[model samples]
Target: MRQAVRSQFTAQRAPWALHRRPFSTSYTRSGYADTLRNLRIGSHTRVIFQGFTGKQATANARDSLAWGTKIVGGVTPGRSGEQHLGLPVLPTVRQAVEQLKPDATAIYVAAHQAAAAIEEAIEAEVPLVVAVAEHIPLHDMLRIHSILKTQSKSRLVGPNSPGIISAVGKCRIGFQPLPCFSPGRVAIIAKSGTLSYETVASTTRAGLGQSLCIGIGGDILPGTDFCEALAAVEHDPDTDAIALIGEIGGIAEMEAASWIREYRSRAVSPKPIVGLIAGIHEVPGRVMGHAGAFTALDEPDAKAKITALVNAGVTMVHHPSDIGEVLREKLQGGSSSRQGILSGLGFGSQRRQMSTVSRRHRTSAQRAVPQQKRHLYLSTAQSVGLLIETDRTIRSGSPAATANSQYLVGVGIDRSSRMPCIIAGHPLDVLSEGHLKRFPFDFQRGPVDIPAEQIASHLGLRNQQTAIDSLSRIIKSLVTIFYEKEAFLLISHLMETDKSLTVVSARFGFDDAAFRIAGRHQQLHEMRDAAAEDPSELEAEQSGIVYLKLAGDDATVGTLVNGAGLAMNTVDALARLGGRAANFLDTGGKATSETVKKSFEVILRDERVRVVFVNIFGGLTLGDMIARGIILAFEELSLTVPVVVRIRGTNEREGQQLIARSGLPLFAFDSFDEAAAKAIELSRR
Candidate 1:
């Protein structure tokens, strides 16, 4: 264990300098509504659609306007002055913004065109802009984020998202089904667009309506995160309770939990908060659906997040459907257990009276009265305080249990080390200003109780005031440890439990290797040996015959493709073929345009690759993405190689068209095998 710990610590510490500072300002909840409110959007906050001529954009625009969105105009570049969905097509955001004075803009453009459209919106000073395109390049996203940050008051929903819906105001700003929601008390905030729709349905079904449902977008770097949304929900008077739907990706949930705890501790009467985290089945290192759903190997997982929230006294549910149920119970219960404990301790109702009376005077005056000074009086009061502290510590799963054992020391009026200490279940309540002063060493909250002895030993104090100071130090230390160790454990567990763990693990390996071998090739046997030694070692070896093994019982679609651009197209085509390509293997710069054939035979050796799609685009290497390799193989082996070929690019117009005109045994298609019929045709032959 010591060796393992040392190795882990050394490995982690060594890379500390190289660790990228996690983008902190990506997610914001407070800025969303605040920016919207600042835009001074009234009944006439007209919106313009950028890609309004397209089917998707037109459909969503029609739905949005029908649902009461003030959509005044649209823009479809070359189709200037044309009308889409009865809205004028102005060709530019500047034209539309000037004419309509619209408060917001929603850009429904393709991923490649998204950045330019967003810039147009910004130039037009459209206060609230929603970009509904997915798969945007990281550099483009960074530029948009940088611009949004500078404007601070302008709101941006997503580069790839479903926008926001405010039920109370009857406003539907994005593409979600507005009929699924009804205005009420619950505010639903989630990272997923589809999941938000599901949550809305569940909440409405459970008889709990929504005040506002915001999908903060599922990108790795979102404009709004959990904590910011929590603040808005916390302040919204119409929102009775908040339903936070988070997935396995970032530390946003954990951060939100800490903030919620802090808020409740200071709040006069805080509302109930319920959380539901998704991606419980996701494997560590494997990305499930959204890019933001990726969890670090050492970060908290869905289960651990749920555990932390539950322990923190936040009503937590594992399923989206259960979120509504748990929230209803919390609401029906009326009182937050946290508030109940605080009130029980006389902090809420009797705080003023308790503070006005000097503690020394109260003690001395009570001692002067013979009845009050009785042994029973002192004994009962002391016992109550001890019991409260013990109960609170036990409930929270306090971390003081992991603290240095030698530091365990108890200080109080009684010399007997066994004197009862009052424990509060919620850590925040116990650490609050009033509670800390009254209980001091006796108060234990959060996971792992701080033993009275540990408190006293650390403080090195003999009196009440010193004990209070000691408790403060202990609280700070415990919080730090919980965030560092406990939070990491939670994220790790979530990553490990995900079904996509293997893919993610492989991806992590690729990323750690700095994407050097991602699109390159390697020899099968040599790659296996290197993988056997250390999977990452294969990245450095760079041997030419790429090897991929499909684990478990899953079927694999073997694809031999040339060039990074064509490789991606082939993989996506395979998905459309009702199959998944096992890996991306590129026979690199070493393979001449003529010698590309050896890569084909090497790719076919793996029996796991049942169907091979040889997709080639003529580049520096002359033949098709797949055909050149096949032609070389036929010349060398003097045999038929069964495969489907889709050849395009460079000289493909002449070569592939000649092959098609020749009516050879090779199966060819100009279009990617949309239905996988071509691959099946060759297999049957």
Candidate 2:
């Protein structure tokens, strides 16, 4: 079987790109998994768009068509008899289904409108539904899940997703950048879009083309998760390995790790799984850029996530750039003819090359640990936890010629108390920016007493009285700036000759909040590059509500939600239903009923908004408070325009009751889908 595969591969100039891909799959196929054939989207899979004629849909369609995807047609309400991007457009999914008989429907609708579009496809019994929109309301997705359970015909790809792409099949369903992809035997499943792109690019360049790449979406709740994608890949005959990219958020990575471990245990020859877990340096209790890029205090961080994968027999990597080289080292570095085929594809002597260099560098650094060292400084707007090896982190540059060099020092504030505390001689010689994981000398918040003698003793400055005094004065200034200017300071590169002491480099970081506050902070605020920023975002920041005016004139629904995650979700829902939001307004966790009224004023400030969609989950802010605020806003603003309120959680029933009796042109809904549908309906009117 191996000889036959090699013979077929050797005969063809480009076996991967050729239509006759007659490679033997006997080794990788363990024959123990049940997966949908739809998981591997093929070149022949006919696709239709849900929100066919929208600007975003048209633009994405152009890209898909160019990428050789089988785009049959699309569905656009009120624009049924139109042609977009050389494809026929219908009014409804059923109409497109009846005409095109599409294998899948790629939903380009807004997030708020996603439930309706997805439901429409499910009703049409489309085989697969790919939702490209982000931030579909969690409530709406929960309902979508319930409805999906009622049937098995429709397999959903994403709500906040980039969608699924089969590089070998040439079938592109989502909005993935097409140029970086190539046809190969490795399947990719990632929660992070940017990382997925990097992996695809890296693997493709390393002559390890991809079979399929699935972006499961970085929402708190994705439509199709890692386990499902993994099952599908495991069953795929084309795929020989897997790249699972997860992050520090939910238990999704842990669950995937468990599944991989269990499956590998039972299989005859399980495929190699290379895992990469993102968000290693994120601050605790803070949500990163992505909606789901957050970890609970009790949940596992990056280290734990990585450990689970490694325990599961998966080769895990810290960065995406390392994935391809590692995969090649695992698969094709041996003596077998098929294994040696990688050399033909230009992966000749570069396997494990970097790791070897890294090992050598480590050995050299370790040897020099006791001989020489220099100060290192690192600080940001937020305090970061770091594991600094005083010896290893020394600059690779040749150490200064001395029996004993300078000690490393870190000058920063204690995150717990926001006080200035300098770590001296143990690793301190000069003022430098860096943080390490450990308890050390403690100091008070207001004024840190850094005497000249203490500096001399800690930094080993030979007690040069004037130099010590200057360093002491600099430390005092840094402490003053830390409290008064709300700044983070780190001074480094202390050049000390027998006769002289001079400061070489220094970095100061200002707190963003300080700029928001009035007075002397205004000078720091003026340093901002205003032209590069979005004006609406700045205005929203000033109003104490997080607001971002979405691009495109088609945004008709003004979105209002409590949390940033939910706000993006609402916008995604609107897009899913073929509607758009004028702006993203997060009323914040501290919002009151009055905040809702004011939020309405801000939403109304966007003249494009025909209707306001208030989708608030009353976890931090109560539902009744949001509802009461809606009524107040309707009265205060004399809002004749429609308001669709989908408020759930604490006192949700009371909130719905208030809206029912107030009778202020407001549509209240217990179900998020129903409310978003109503908002899209009213937005159209």
Candidate 3:
């Protein structure tokens, strides 16, 4: 492993000052059946598709099948017994389940229909269901997740994900570019599909092929999360390590960190984990980047996620390009000091490619993306490869992608020596606030300070006054986009030529909230491509609800609390105690019978919800009213699911007495622990 990585990095960089250390070298191979059985994906797994006859599905199916994947059959309603894409198309998942007995089903239905498709797959007991649609209604996801909790037989990969790909297994369930993945020992689990490819490219470049790669999806609450995927990878003997790539929003990274710590304690020889979170991700409500202009990552959410993983013994790197090198270092026990170039610039050793010069400038490989699209919003290295899928075989005859006259590098352009070079979001404006996560570098409230010499050093260029001036000017324009457009991330490939620097390909990620703000950004809002947006998400916003689907298969309890904070707490406490919550419903402090009835109506919509836990602490609301409402709603909805109510504050005793006299199947308690315990017990029963 050391030799492979060392030689690879050496080939990319110039001579380096040598350092020495000793390390152990050990490796183990994996088998088809024993690997990823929890994820229900393996070498022999028979894969099928839901909505297989749809336009997008058909196109992807063609590409996937051609990539040497085992596609057995599919499910397309009203097309039963029909053949599509040279595979049998059944009318329903149930029919396909009965006949084909596929190991996994990749859902390709539209967002509105994604939940139903997943529910049908779970009902049919398909071992693994990978939902490919993005932005399934939050309520739909909650229902599907609730249904999943009823049984231990089914697992869901995504609702808006790239899906799982096992190069060794020859099973490609999602829509990841095929050329990017290679068969090896590392199982990569990434939140961003685009960044996952960058890691794959990096690891593969180091000659470390992947055993499996699972994109848990970019959704805030995906069906399968990092912890689940990490645990699943743990069971795969062939996977010796993990490349965990996450974005800057949510507690997924933090939770995964907790799991890693616990995992370290249990395993005799734990698999090495290397994590990389390099972008300013845009979640629905929060944004990551800039000073007062952005939701600074200084808030514990972003920084803590990265810090947690690092503290949990995850070898965390700052860039995707460094994943392979760090993985090699960790797997080799880091007892061996690195030999080749210092990997400060990441891009150098990852693929050893500099950048594309202007087409008129050179015949070296060059790709031109359509410049007409207004909002590209590309996430990371992965999104930049959108144009790359078409160019599989190009630019072969070169020592490397780098050029003697051309330098390809990405930098944050700090103020050090007039310009400190770092990398940041889609638009270059990320340098100012992106450093909050790495306070040791720049704890200040502005862009970092570094000299042009440092930027030139990383890119292996001589820092001359003219060159420095040119770079400063170019970087300033890029940085201006952040404040102007509220761009949180920037993905661009820039190359410097004899005349000037040119951007061959670039993509930007503007904050979602920026569009909502009035004034200058309103034009950006107008430029929004509704056709490309997730329809279900738009509908949810129109309903004035902040519903986000969370993923957990063992969650069985349905939580209906008075506020969002309480709803979240109930769900968290339930999970901490080994109880899974079906959905998080906030009633907005209403304790009336109508509110209760409405809540019950929504909760019971998911028939798999075996127990409903009502946790309401009265402030302005009366506990007695809540109890009476619960009883009324129970009778009105004809709900058979057991109810566990924990109400406190005003008239708490009255609420308990009311429930006791109601003679309905409801348990009212003053203690939250007891109520929660009862809910968990009923769910299991």
- Clash count of each predicted structure: 53, 27, 20
| lDDT, ranked from best to worst | 2, 3, 1
Off by over 4 Å in 1: 1-44, 334-685
lDDT of 2 by residue, 396-457 (tens): 22234452454333354322121244534422211111222111222211222334455555
The residue-level lDDT of candidate 1 at 539 comes to 38
Cα error, candidate 1, residue 213 (Å)? 1.0
Q: Once model 2 is optimally superposed onto the true structure by TM-score, how far is the C-alpha of residue 626 displaced, in angstroms? A: 39
> How many clashes show up in model 3?
20
lDDT of 3 by residue, 40-142 (tens): 4667878898888888788778887887777888988888768987789999888898899898999988666677788787767777889876545432453
TM-score of each: 0.47, 0.47, 0.45
Clashes of 1: 53
Evaluated with lDDT, which candidate comes out highest? Answer: 2
lDDT of each residue in 1-685, candidate 1, tens digit only? 2243233223333221232232223234554346644322334567778887888778777777776777888888877767777778887877887887777777888766787788777756777787766556443454455455545446676755677777766666667656567777888887766456556766787788888776777665565566666775676777887877777655666667677777888988777877666644333334444544544322455554555555455775433445566667678875433311212222122222212111111111111112110001112233223223422431111233322211221111110111112222212221123221212221111222334343333333344343443343333332232222111110000011111110010000111111121222122112222223323213312444333333334445566654322343344445434566644444532245344555545555555555667665443344443354566566575544455666544455565765565444666775454324566444434
